[model samples]
Target: MTSRVRLGSLIAMLAVAASGCSTELPGSAIAAEPSATPAISDARSGEVFGDLKACDLLEPTTTPKGFAAPEIERYESDNGCAAQKRGYASVSIYLVPEAGIDQLSPGQGTKIPTKVGGREAVEIPGDSGTEACTVAIAVTPNARMTASTSLNEGTNEEACALARELAVAAEPKLPRVG
Candidate 1:
């Protein structure tokens, strides 16, 4: 067969084979089907913390060393607060509804499982060369509160420690999870 005809035939054969392929696991009789709705539990339904503000969860006394009182800010869909000490450190708190600890990405850093107020949490160390860290505390399967710290002169461990401290301070203010 000519090269063009052979290539056409090969492409057609591949298309036919691909169409018959199933994503089911080998030896599994049932093929998993995608759910029409997400598998979110009642605790994670984004309604438990309705109208709660992130800044309200953190008090001025909770500010880390070298940072000033937190300044409250409300975003379109989320609430947060930030505290900063010029040339030292900046700390922020964010309340994320419908987002869980599992959704927290470490990027180039690492996620260390931890707990805040006996609730599941993750401590994410800053990426290389950055003095920043985050602690995410799970409120439910779909909601979490994050405390992030960035320092001008400090190690990742220090940042992580501060972040965890902030998370701990704010955890008690959250609604109890089932």
Candidate 2:
């Protein structure tokens, strides 16, 4: 199981590095160095991309720090349209367990897009026993994603909403030469 987790982490890291951009990891902004972590060899499960390029997902063991702040486990996939000059698809799913975090969507008078970066954003309410929250942001574009989180961890709807915001944040990371 530990090996599986490490392998998942490595794939997730590669996907992010390939994009040439830095993203936050679940629980903290600090990253685990590749040279320090051992590699895992195993047959992977779950299907993400069909025709498009799909990378591994990052699973976090801790909670995040701020609003609409990017969770660390998301991965970006390039569409392979070398000449299109478009950016890679960014995806991240994080749990926001704060009481009001789940309700952190744009203000009542605010406007939000259902889909950003070609990936639709969704929020599912949840509870971690200690708090009432939501399972926010199961993002995927150029791929499919399914997230089933535990109820004991609480939810952060605000953070989930932020995941979408973070995914779109990749817009500036695209290559200027592309």
Candidate 3:
């Protein structure tokens, strides 16, 4: 598992605040380093990507049109995967057996139940009226796929919509074994 501090720092870096333009992590900002080889190797089970280190789950070749590929980066198993697209939206998809520290779409904004890939899901804004949103989808009884983002590239609704779309796109690629 990735250290809580590292995961926290990574997630923190993506957090959007009510202050705007000043997204700050809880601790010092940790620069993303080369992650060609992810820390957790056994987690590799995605039907499409095969492994997390490949970072192909959300690549341009895998995603739909208009949505550019992100430079997938991670700290370890704990950090999952994250990317802040240069021209597209900044997003993170944290696959978790349990929830811990997540700065993106922090807490529960406004809970709006919805469906993704024929599965029940919930969309929550980072905060009421904020330009950030998150979608939490259950992958199993003890696991979930959390897609989150801060709307630096679009409106609040768009961010939430993107989150849902990303989740739908990611569902098929997820590991069946997990």
What's the best-to-worst order under lDDT?
1, 3, 2
Better of 2 and 3 by TM-score: 3
lDDT of 2 by residue, 1-178 (tens): 9999999999999998889865655585678666754432212212222232211122221112221222334222232111110131223432221212224443222323354444444434333322222222322222223222222232445434433343344322321110
lDDT-better candidate, 2 vs 3: 3
Question: Candidate 3, residue 175: CA error in Å?
Answer: 4.2
Highest-TM-score candidate: 1
lDDT of 2: 0.32
| 1 or 2, greater by lDDT | 1
Per-residue accuracy of model 3 over 32-96 as CA lDDT, tens digit each = 99876544333333322233432454554224444445555553235355666556666777666
Global lDDT of each model? 0.78, 0.32, 0.59
Which candidate tops lDDT? 1
lDDT of 1 by residue, 13-117 (tens): 999999999977677577779976545464544476767777776654355354667788654135788888898887788887767889877866888999889
Which run of 10 residues does model 3 get worst, by summed lDDT? 41-50
